[model samples]
Target: MTSAAPVATESGVPLRKPRIGLLGIMQALYDHMIPGITERQSGYAREIADRLADVADWTVGRPVKDRTDAEEVMREFVNADLDGVMVVLLTYGPAMRVARLFNENRLPVLLANIQPEPQVTAAWDMADMTYNQGIHGAQDTANAMVRADRSFEVITDDWRAPEFAERVDRWARSARAITAWKSLKVGIFGYAMNDMGDIRVDENALLRALGPEISFVAPGDLYRGSLEVPGAEVDALIAWENARFEVDPDLTAAEREDHARMQLAIEKILVERGYRAYSTHFDAIGEDGRFRRLPLAAASSLMAKGYGYGAEGDALAAAMVYAGHQLIGEGHFTEMYAMDFPSDSILMSHMGEGNWRVARDDEPVRLIHRELGIGRLEAPPTFLFRYRPGPATLACLVSLGGERFRLVVAEGEVLDAAPLPQLEMPYGQFRPDSGVRACMDGWLAAGGPHHQVLNVGRHAEDWRVFCRSSGIEFVQV
Candidate 1:
């Protein structure tokens, strides 16, 4: 069954429509007698597909007429560049042979085994009423894929049960959700820091599994744009704000003016480049008359409002994008610190950017500051904070969890744990943020790999979908 459209009612986040693929349901009658019913499992399989059609956009049934059927299905999946595919096991015929066909194409396949609810009086009388037909069919399909070293997402909920429709619908929706990830695109600005150089990660590795793409930019480009701000640009900034969130009363006059200018610059870049997501530098200011802010707060705010951002991007941004896509929510930024590190769980959270659409709205959020004396910003120590607004899948662009490239994907919640208490410690507070604690828990418990990235809204899964399309590992949490 296909899932219902994701409604905002489930959360403040909007529902994303997934472009999904459907595998013909087949009745594997290798050992069981063919039902007196006509045409094996063809009609039943189509009905199952019809049920999903009501909720999603899909093309169903690659009837295994021959090896060509598998090839045709694979071709369609690739050409359509679909997000996810649902394979309903009706029979273990040539239909089963096609499971790996799409898997190799990196399409996440959902192994669905659903039987019609309410067995008919004739179902059993027919001498071939096989309730386990659907169940066993899927198991065998999974077996075939596994034999070929393939992995798949399976939904074995009883469709004949009272809540069958709801369960099937939700899975269908989730499958679609995963599909959305396949089309994710991420934007990158600024180069990796030569210092703290250890944070580099392998973006291609993530691209191999995730579907997001990086848009390269120079630090000076943003700085140049900031200095060259114009009146028309300012107006465009307001328009972006309106699209992002409702402007609120809490914003100070100074905040509004600054926001007005910053928003214009960002909007110019995003609109000009056709980017829906981004990751950028936090300390790329200029010397003398020119200066720039890393736009950390801005990144946080936009991501929370449904856009995605990876700070220092590289690989970490991509990882967070994947986690956000998987978790179906925003991913916050996080870092590793021994004392604050979770023996168990930890999540990350941050108040959004001062100029971001979400931040302009001033939704209730905790406010934290940089640890005194940790490191001084060359610019004024103002509200230019680098925070991940929600729990996320942490990642890096460097390799070996170090300088080359690595992505962090996490799943967790926000916590109100107090910030580090006064003590003889490192310059910056060496403790974890309350939000980070919540996220850490999610990462450890969910077994979502840890590190850090910017995942703040419902689109992260789309980022994961992008990862799959791009051939990056979408580690589960």
Candidate 2:
């Protein structure tokens, strides 16, 4: 049978734009006391929404003046299925009028403490007080939210400030990440590595805390699928790989074809089943000699194409890497293997699996053969390269038992390094902003797992915001 189109050709994860609902709040008494106060303040809300137009998918609601107006507007926001709500206090509104609605709805809230005027000056008059004096209202609402045990973020600044827009954009991105997390589905082939305690997680707890659906696949199914992959597709994949990466001359034609068939089969399963992330146990795949070679290259290629993959059936790491991809566009699956005390750098690598897209520009990725001493298996073709030297973030999601997960993150730099031809795996040397000793101490103290996702750039604050929105604990070292 003819095979389906290759899923590996897709370049990056397609993220849906974050949907945000903007609502303005004001006291009902203002309508009678100041004839045009509500209408004028509503104009300020529209201006702020317009400024944030490019940042998110905005659904602007009419200014809410009393319980009646608040209920109606809140209904609109709910109907819009927003990722979050930006509550703009247009004027001095009573907290009781809208605080309960926020508490009950439980949507991630951004209390916009922005004012129309940047500063009070000689030109400031009663009109400025009527329109720009919304900070006190924000304070009142925040106090009520705290008493009611609700989570929120308060952004205080003049709406016109560049920083204000940047902060809003960050919040919108975090909201989008949270939305993606809620809809994530991860697949696992075979069980986790035998007696691997650190990577073990309680699936029920994981689902409750992180909102990912886990689907387990039998190893036999993968073996059968690999056999069914069309020879034409396998040849095409081998040609594509040869063009992109440096194929070792020692790799035989049969070896390349077998690896290509396995890779195609894995990609087909993931794409057809709508799995955003996946994991496989090496020992299990090697068991019974169903797979002559482990599919390490398959994992590497999938990761390069923006599909999350964790070696040794690490489902949590798989999901976390996917989340990192959604937030930062690229993420690499890795673990700290050794520490260089003299250089203050930690050696990071995995068992012949990593996103080759993160390789240094100066070096070409090499697809080489690897030997697995496990269960009647031969050497498989996998990638070997040096990670890009730049600022990066190392992050992991660890379960703190039932319904509790903490995101441990560290901002670091991947030091300039040459590929270790002797190691025969994708590797990098990372120096944390905090010294190696301190970073290690802090990471261990925060219950960090060995398997972590690395992404380019410093994203601790983005993760902090994401954790707050999703109710996960954030620990940055």
Candidate 3:
């Protein structure tokens, strides 16, 4: 099952580009340090900050010289709400003070072990050598963080190196994504599909490990809200879908309106609750019979508008989708639907609900009947389309007991799902870079869950950095 065209919903989450702030700090002794050499060292620190501006949105803070100055700089960072802080050490200074400040504030730290000069020149003198030397300072800072049991990253290279700037930008992106996750709200409607142990998560453990808060939404709220939606609103949604997609004539007008009403009600519920993502069990929602319509349209539409939607009450997957979307720009909620050994590919899909934004632009989704009642003629409307083929990554964030989670990721190439006459659902065909048999065996060995978030680009590196920065286990499949 799929969904209708995207709508301009008022409650949609606002997408913001990640911003990274830079801080330059030097450890200088008031009386012992050479004044002229320290001044040149600070100049080098400023240059590093200036170069970083070409890669990311950064604010270079005033260089700190002591513990008191470090605390003050951290205060400024908090006030500015910087995503991550890059500490550029000018000389061997107070590593313990910087580590304490970063730990207390719980900010992601990137230690810039950047040297002022790419290499030692023949004309270099004592002052020039000392000014360019920051390696020991970075080492000291890293040692301090490790002793404090804090997580941090190190980047050591010349400031002028393109690779150096790129690495900094990637860290910035990961940090920004982590910052966004602190206040994530995931709403769970209905119950988890019965007997899916892998999808079941300990709520307290999840909250303690990741900052996202989960809440339950009653089915009655959605059912009543859908019924109360004005006919004009539903008609407007249908008209919007009609203009954008090629709706199959087989679907009755009432079916389309039914989907529209459900979609609008869900949007209102999530918006009113300030939820950025949601999970639901279609079976449980309709079990009472008053609301038999599965929220296929709701799930797909919400995903397109930057909201994560997980089928079968998989709240973890929902949050994972949102995180990937923030870090990767676009992520589709999917599962291993089937294996096509002959084609050396895996058919990935779900019962319904996928990010339509990831669908192929060349092939628009078709309105299809979701015949879930076995032999019933009455069914809801859903979308069916092939996802855009390209390089992609599949990831699953699985729980590993109290306050522990592991990220399972695999890199692959996304291929177009062939249009077989019997295939009626939206899907993306993926060929794992590791080959089908090896990927399948490794995935099963790792106990990867049935559900995952598929992203358009290869983000295994980003995810690895993110997991490390966030203090989660990362297991590559």
Candidate 4:
């Protein structure tokens, strides 16, 4: 079985390479009238396919000249698990040859409005027309797709241009993200935090809108799993943590072992059950004496391993964080705790968890034990660090109503600042592109929720493409 982990960069940004089908279209009548036209067009199709192979896992088909050829190519694409289809109009083929196939199929379509020649001069003749008239065919197919209400994008440019390849890459990534969203599975360890209206969602409505299947995990399962964790596993985890983090002297060896046990148990259950993301509620941790302390450290460690986490049972936030990680690479669940007018920044922090992998390289992540003020539990070991300073994007997914959702996004910068030792949690300061005040006002107007996924990159355009492909309302601040 393939591991569920995404392909990421050194800094942990996910690059979702998509699988697509590339089919070239041409008119059979022209092939008979001009003996070499089909061969020349096929060569262009081959070159374009080769150029795009690095961006996607492309299954290239021979040039389609008639209805029979179109049907055969369509069958191949339908049989395979493809994210989308890339249709190249080599010359003017009838729209009916492939328009109905696209209308009936569910995969997203990208129309390549390109020709063999980049320019048409006084030297242009009938022979050149037979090979370089694909633009009209692209327009014909695009019109039919629009009439049929199909989701398609047209790229009209020289195939060798950088922008053309970039657009194709963007569409491929967006299509892959859409596929990932449709099959996402999130384990809900506890119910949503009470009275948190913004974080609560209707499961059925959420499934219909975003396609994440929710599964409730009983507390007894975690309890059993924790007890079953071997002593060697716990010891290895503690040693790993000690080697990677600045361990606090105040934390006892027993406390470290207990934290490692909880982390191991969480990892085992999530991996065994194939969960992409999860949420935890402090109130549910020790309710039945199943846990000695809250498993606060697991959240950070799992996130570093590419699992999404949301605190206080915010499953919507969890799903968004997972998607952000898969779409961009570094995703941390956070809330805007305070506004600093002097610096025009918002203090972003979470309760006790973050993707520790995104911590600034200048400082080591500190492992410290902290008490839960609300629960009758022992102090839990968690990581404390500041996010790396860089360009960032804040994204929140919220329900608008039944079967409807919206994605609110803001482009910002994580300011370069010293870590606040007083705040014993993962934290960072973010300054929005439009300044803090204007951004906050716009965010509120768009119904942006408190819990959000903070990622280290300028990925607002990526989010926009994802939202467009997934049928979600996108509001940018």
Query: Pick by lDDT: which candidate is best?
Result: 2
Per-residue lDDT of 263 in model 2: 82
Tens digits of per-residue lDDT for model 1, 1-477: 111111111133454555667766443344345543225455666666566565556766555434567668767876886766777655444435555574465666666666554445654643444533556656666777777665565555654454645444554555554454445556666554456554454555444444445557665566555656765544554455445444444444444445455544564566567565666545333222244223444554455445555544444444344445344444444444443345243323322232122221223232222233211232211233223234433443334432222233444433334434332111112222334555456445443433354433333344443334333454433
List TM-scores for all candidates, in order. 0.65, 0.93, 0.92, 0.91
The digit string of per-residue lDDT tens for model 3 on 1-477 reads: 122223545344565645665666666663264666656666766677677775666676777878898888778887888888888877666677677776576778888887777888899976666666668878887888888888777888777989988888778878877887777889888777889888888887787777777788888888888887877778778887787777888888778877888888888888778888898786777674776567776687678788877788898899899888787777689999888888778998887678877888898777677687621324867778788889899999888788888888999888865675676677878999888898989888777888999988788998998888888888787
| Tens-digit lDDT track of model 4 for 1-477 | 222222222343345578888889988798678998877888888788788878888888888977778888888986887887889988898898877777786676788888888888999889888788888898888888888876666678899988889888877877776776777888877566778889888889888766887888887777777777877777767777777789999998878878877777777778788887898788778575767788887888888777888887888888888887777776788899999999899999977888887788899899997766655888888789998999999999978889788999999999997668689889999999999999999999999999999989888888887876667888999
Backbone clash tally (model 3) = 1
- In model 1, the worst 10-residue window by lDDT is 1-10
Sorting all predicted structures by lDDT, with the top scorer first, yields: 2, 4, 3, 1
lDDT by residue for model 2 (348-445), tens? 99988899888899889999977767545888898999999999999999888888889999999999965565898899999999989999999999
**Candidate closer to the true structure by TM-score (higher is better), 2 or 4:** 2
lDDT of 1: 0.47
Report the C-alpha displacement of residue 121, candidate 1, in angstroms: 8.3
- Quantify how close model 1 is to the true structure by its C-alpha RMSD in Å: 8.3
- Compared with the true structure, model 1 gives a TM-score of 0.65
Error of 1 at 288 (Å): 10
Error of 2 at 65 (Å): 2.9
List the candidate numbers ranked by TM-score, top first. 2, 3, 4, 1
CA displacement after TM-score superposition, residue 446 of candidate 3 (Å): 1.9
